[model samples]
Target chain A: MTSTSSPSRKALSKIACNRLQKELVEWQVSPPAGFKHKVTDNLQRWVVEVVGAPGTLYASETYQLQVDFPEHYPMEAPQVIFLHPAPLHPHIYSNGHICLDILYDSWSPAMTVSSVCISILSMLSSSTVKQRPADNDRYVKNCRNGRSPKETRWWFHDDKV
Target chain B: MAAEEQEVRMEVEAVQAVYGDDCEIIHDFPPHLHVHITPRTADDSSQQFVEAILGILCDAQYPQKPPHVHIVDSKGLDENREKHLITTIENKAKELSSCLMLVALCEEAVELLSDMNHPEGNCPFCLYPLLVEDQSGTFAPFMKLMSCYHCFHSECIIRWWKWLQNEIIDSKQCDSTISTSAGNQREMEQQQQQNCPVCRKLFDAKDIEHILDYAGTNSSQPTDVIVEMDGDERKFLECESENNRRQQFESLLKLQQENSGLIEPRKEIVVVPGMYLPTTVMPTLAAIDAADEQHLDSGSTAPEAVDLNIPSNKATTSKHRDMNTRRKNRNHSSRRQPNVYPNRTQWIKKEAVSSDP
Candidate 1:
């Protein structure tokens, strides 16, 4: 599961810390449906449990998402990955990396953790097939050194989930 | 008919008063009026973002039949918005059928215009409402692209534009490193296509540059691109602390003057002949002298004499006479440090005697 693996060594900046705190408060007030934030002391890393939507192929299945914020977070996208025993999904790699554009090049500062969570949940809920990506084994081997998903140049060829 | 004519005349006068120069009478006989209506919001007027010129045609039957309202011209408003505006006004006129409703109709038009004043829909970049709907009523100010009429929050568009510029600059930097013909071709392609973030419409840099000032002022985020680009965080922190240190020094000086009569009561301090000191430096000298006297009374001579010599060396550079005064100051500084002061005093005394001849 690479439980001890950290995404980046850089510490969160003051602005990133402040914004994350705000997001934490908002999340506590009204968390996204099908998601539960695991309470932890660390502000830089968040582990959330996602319950697959009722109608999806992975319905009722539970998956863990690990979100690690970069130093220039909000400006930079958080590295979001599924924990080991990842769901069988075409866009998600076996190494837990997800090929989502918003978590990479499409990221905007205005998007918060809550918004990202919703986008991921929606991506999961709309999947028509339960299968790993074609090159998942090769990609996972390449990322054996614990590479962040943000470093991946994602090719978002499919608009459909 | 005469009474009806008077009522129409009064209504026309009322509309003129309400709309001022916006209300223009094309023909007086049948009361053909043109009223230019814009939203009441200050941004709408400054941007000229939305406005409608309504032409009202009144038949001879007049008040009995509601006046015909049609949109003559408008900017930044689509056909649907224009129709909705005229329809709302026409409905108001129908309700006020038998009475002189010209002024009321114009007011209603203004009210509706204001309601629909803002640029519609979300910012393309963030997909958030540009004008937020909430109790706080805070919304990011939006600007319309002059060429395409596509609107976006000032901050969003600016950020995207800056990001594009940075991408180009970065590519240019990479080109030099690569120095390949293929890289040059890619750079040329990037230069040729700086499309609108939303529409992919070709827009010149000037289109966004014109509103750069507005974007800068309207930005709510603390971290601006300029600050990030400069990356002078250490320099900014140093300057801040430097200011704090200066302020602390000034306050300490002020406190010392207040406690001890360190400074002469301004008017009474006659300037010493041939001694030129800035007013601020004078207080510092007086404070040092006062501290020196206190040290002498306490009989701690060695350290006090050393401290006094340091100031004397700094305060007087050209004159041997100032040196004599400083030796006197040092003598007064501490009685216990007689060995150090006596030697300096003897040297100054000899100098004074030699200069007197």
Candidate 2:
């Protein structure tokens, strides 16, 4: 059973729209290294392509990340998850639900999509073993009902990649 | 020589007109001038956010050679921003290579300063743009950490500071078995210094506390006063208090009118001399009773006697005392009702339902 949690359908607030526009302009001017923003008309959802940094275990490999911004973005953390063919890493679940702290409790509004992409890529590059989390099967089963990973009560015990 | 001197005077006057008191003439003959430049908004004579003093030195050859430009001093501008400003001015000078460009150079500096007037980049805590370009007046108020100059939305930083304080308190209470030497040292450091959330530089708690004080006084619904309870609990309490406040205000207004013949015709109220209370006492009496009601509603001790004594010094009418006692009794009875939300969701739903119509 593979279920992806449906994102909230609420429209982006005026502040969120304005901020995202600024971020888009900035990304066009100077995007983070090894990342490309897959441009779309929807400001609320962003699909970005990330290339693993050189010399890391996952180097030369590419992954797609989907970020969904809540109506009260910056006040609330964006929901970020991997697309199909999710990265095989200790912190990343098979269902593309990332266990990264910044994606959950440790997220600061000060982070941009560009900064987030950089962090995700860094997480990928530091992987010594390409494998799903130890409890991936159980977690994926629990999320089979298409639960948005934002609802997960994540325990971030690991600081090291 | 006379022609050159006259030209220099005219150039100085032009620079002075543009810069006003900001332009200082160090030398008239060779035309060495110091002009203070600050970024100004389109209108308004208020002080600009950033300012710089530029020293302009002209050689004896005048128009044949471009003047030497150097930054004298600046405030609220970083080294990089200062470099950008100087580089921009230098480029403008190079573009207009050789003519009497003193006033023009001053104008370019003012333009650049005006463009650079606002602080750049994301607020350190929230990662949002420090200055939202599209929204004209809806920008969230932000403050700089006095030590590091890292800026954050006043609300965001205050929330983080409060969270930190709560964590420290919780850790202290639970420190019995968890007291390792290393842990103790870190705890001691945390106690001795509070660091900036973004830069990790030491910042005085007094800075945030000052803003917290202001927030408490300025806003009726301050986040800190809401207390760190679950969402439902907070919402219920807020809604209940809001309803109570409205009721209290309405009652107070009614009392004010009844006592002072404000709404009723003066002829109908029949203000008999000697039997009537002074007009000034009516509002104060109503205010004291309202305050007393609020104190009781919040479950705080009613300081009615202290308030009543101050105002009663002038007009101590027996009828007013009787009314005060009656209102106090009514407040006491209302205060007995427990402020609990048994079915939180149902209460919220009911509130929503009532508000919808």
State every prediction's TM-score relative to the real structure. 0.47, 0.48
Q: How far is candidate 1 from the true structure (C-alpha RMSD, Å)?
A: 22.6
Give stretches of model 2 more than 4 Å off. A1-3, B1-141, B153-197, B200-206, B209-220, B227-357
If you superpose only chain B onto the true chain B, what TM-score does each candidate give?
0.42, 0.43
Cα deviation of B182 in candidate 1 (Å)? 8.9
- Cα deviation of A148 in candidate 2 (Å)? 2.4
Model 2 is docked with a DockQ of: 0.14
| Residue lDDT tens for model 1, B40-93 | 865333444577889999989999999999988775576788888888888899
**CA lDDT for candidate 1:** 0.64
Q: How does model 2 fare in lDDT?
A: 0.64
Model 1 agreement with the true structure over A124-155: per-residue lDDT tens digits: 98999989999888888776666666656689
For model 1, the docking class works out as incorrect
Locate the minimum summed-lDDT window of 10 residues in model 2 chain B: B347-356
